[model samples]
Target: MVQEKQSDRQQRLDNFLQAVEAAQKVQDDIMKYGLEAAHLYCDDIDGDWLETWEEDEDGQQSFVELVTNFLQSDDLVAVKVRKQLKDKSLQEIAVNLEKCLSLSEEDDRIFAVKKVLLRGVAVAESNRGTSSDEIDEIELLDLAEELLDKLAEFLVSINR
Candidate 1:
């Protein structure tokens, strides 16, 4: 019976590890495709007017497709993991924030901004209502704004 119990525990551990690995792979793929699409879009925009214009349509279409697939797959995995975890630990929240800031477009950046802000508000409210820990709501809001600014700057540099 003890041996059987041990084997069952091991199997559960193995399953958890596999799930984490799968989640990481999804995150990596999302970043890879997102960055690639950003690069392609940036390149097609920042060049001689006629040359860039000629290639813009096809490049934009390809970039859009890549981004669409990445978002759908990555968001699905993210939602699943977030649901499973229930509480978003600081590390997990940071990872998601980083991914959001890496997006190149204003609309994409806004999505990330909204996510972080929403998370911050939720965290703050929960903490305030429950415990007396000094949770700095202003700090959390500042961090989100900083991320948005950094992403905007990066995008501007790509355009220039």
Candidate 2:
């Protein structure tokens, strides 16, 4: 029994270390490419996901699709954050953003990644709450800027 327990623990530790290494690789990618680095982890994204904000006659992507993609992503960061924050309302999302900001201040790489994903979730939730008419052109632009700022902060944190 003791030997079996020891073996199990060793296996668990090995899996954890492997996960950490993979997360570090992801952090390196994020450092190099900012938020666009998501494409690196998400090669399986479909044609719909490729659609941009622009209104091309052949393709159309809404905020709903983007948010759904984030929620469904299998990337380590997204998976971990989804496990941590199941269903967040706009107000809860604000609290999570503040928590993420605090976590980002830490020196840990894992925390940095977690904070970035948390912020992403918060932004997605905020966007999900809005109707097309409720959020005018300016609000959409502002949201994009805010996402960029969060990505910049995340890159800085990981670089440190």
Model 2 residue 60 distance off true place after TM-score fit, in angstroms = 18
TM accuracy, model 2: 0.30
Error of 2 at 19 (Å): 1.0
Q: Please give the lDDT score for candidate 2.
A: 0.53
C-alpha TM-score for every candidate: 0.27, 0.30
Tens digit per residue, CA lDDT, model 1, 1-160: 9999999999999999999997887677667896564454455555576644523433442222333233334454334334333555535554565577668786666666566556645665575584524545454445456545644544454344
Best by TM-score: 2
Candidate 2 residue spans exceeding 4 A from truth: 44-46, 49-160
Q: What is the lDDT of residue 142 in candidate 1?
A: 55
Candidate 1 residue runs with Cα over 4 Å from true position: 1-90, 102-104, 129-143, 151-160
| Alpha-carbon lDDT, every model | 0.54, 0.53
